[model samples]
Target: MKLPKALAFDVFGTVVDWRTGIAEQAAAFLARYMPGTDPGAFADDWRNLYQPAMEECRSGRRPFRLLDALHLETLVQLLERRGIGTAAIGEGELLDLAYAWRRLRPWPDVPPGLAQLRKLFPVVTLSNANIALMIAMNRFNGLEWDAILGAEVSRSYKPTPQAYLASAAALCLDPQDLCLVACHHSDLAAARACGLQTAYVDRPMEYGGARAPDGSYEQAWEWRAGDLLELVRVFTSH
Candidate 1:
């Protein structure tokens, strides 16, 4: 099948190594602020809260909140749970730590693949990350993006049709004209349900290879590749 006119990517695990990036930042911050915390496990714990936090809004338990605000709230709760009181960690320190999400390192293939992919299609993000967070990460990591369109734009998180549909609307394209490139099956499945094309990028090490992907790739998808470079090749070759 021919590719779509625009590509919207899932930024977290698809484009960047969040685990290592968060662990590194947490290590640097906690070493000076709160000693004896395992940085890697700490990173995992923080990420572990991502879905449920978003679910609060998704389930309509709370109004739409930016990922940045969720991150801050989660961090404060985590610190207190670890017995690191607010007095021990000031507001400035908490804010700095929460902003670590903006400093993630890209997967090795990301920059080159995105640079090449941009030549063929209008490439933008469809992440749950807020607009400011996305912009900061792109500038910090030197990613090539035509626009940032995602949860913040729609005020709706992924798997919700609004997030995907809103992204297409932002670019003034039909949902069918846009492809959602992601490492998570649930993400692509949701996009497919909304009539958008799906491209799966295999990131076996997204969770440090500790867990397998949700299922086999037996279902039909527009494209699947081992990495972004491979996805770029698939697009260019067809």
Candidate 2:
């Protein structure tokens, strides 16, 4: 198989451990306000709203908004359902909680593995995350990237053709020359449909192993690895 000219990563679950990071912050925030709430459960519920929130923008039912805004909107809704209102939790505190997305920790293998992979191909993030949040995550996690390209750049979310295609275009590469590396099959499937190459990186703990991860795909992708390190091995061996 031909090697890709560049590699595009899906950041939220694939590169960073969003669930754990969010849970840690949520735990702190909840302890102060909603003392009895389960932070992990709260994190899960917050994440559950991710797709539907983006779907509104993806379907053109709403104009494009940054993930940060979408996150805050959902967080407010979640809090209200639990009998907490914006008046109870001031806007500044709410903003802090919403900004927790910017401080996620990377998966254990991510830093070194990504460093090695960068030696072989240009690696850039193609995530739904807005630029400021991505920048914060990179700084917080010591992740060095060639570029950040995704929803904010494309003005569209993943599973939408524009998100993948625009990222490749931004890199001055053809869709086929850029391989999308993601933990989600649905993400890879979407990239594949848009003419980009695909690599599946298994992230079984993405959801804290609450159930099986979204690891299944109908057709084989161009590459599959247990993690970024394994993908590095695949590239070097070839």
Candidate 3:
């Protein structure tokens, strides 16, 4: 495959461990608000809402929304279910917690791998997460992206053609000239459909409490790596 001019990352599952990050933040929030809630179990419960929440939009039961909005709603519902009464929390707090994703910890290899890749490619985030969230995340996580981009600009999230096309167009590159690097096959498949090259980075611990289902790493990826640093080495021949 030809070298790509831009490297677009799938933020949530690929770059950061959203499950662990959300769980850790939820534990802190619960300790502060609800008090005594298990960050681990609470995290599992909170994440359970993720797919169903998106299904609501994809199924047309609700209109499409940015991932941030979906995440807040999920958190609120989780708070209530964990015996965390709604009156105990405020919308401001929910919003703040949603912003917690911006500060999420990168997988062990992310920062260093990015440092290596940045020297060879213009790195940017192509995520379902919104701009404010992405910017806050950049500062929080010490990410060094040359640019932050998202479905916020396209007004649609991943698996949507508009989102992928909009990213390449926004970056002023042909789809084939850009590579979408992500752990999720769903995301990279979308990029492939949009005419981009693809690389699959493994984040086997994205689910936090459990490993990703077996064979998830063996999808129809053009290139696969154990981590981002390995990916950079594979791409740059360094």
Best of the candidates, lDDT: 2
C-alpha lDDT (0 to 100) for residue 116 of candidate 2: 96
User: Per-residue error at 3 for model 2, in Å?
Assistant: 0.5
Score candidate 2 by lDDT.
0.91
Clashes of 2: 0
Worst 10 residues of 2 by lDDT: 210-219
lDDT of all predictions: 0.89, 0.91, 0.81
Candidate 3 residues lying further than 4 Å off, grouped into runs, are 31-37, 55-64, 213-218
Q: How close is candidate 2 to the true structure, as a TM-score?
A: 0.96
lDDT of 3 by residue, 1-238 (tens): 7788999999887888877887777777777876776777776677678778877875668888878788888877876766677675677877888777777888889999999999898998888788888888888888878887767887776777887889889999999998999888777777898899899987767776476553453457777799998998799772
Error of 1 at 48 (Å): 0.9
List TM-scores for all candidates, in order.
0.94, 0.96, 0.87
Better candidate number, 1 or 3, judged by lDDT: 1
Candidate 1's TM-score reads: 0.94
What is the descending lDDT order?
2, 1, 3
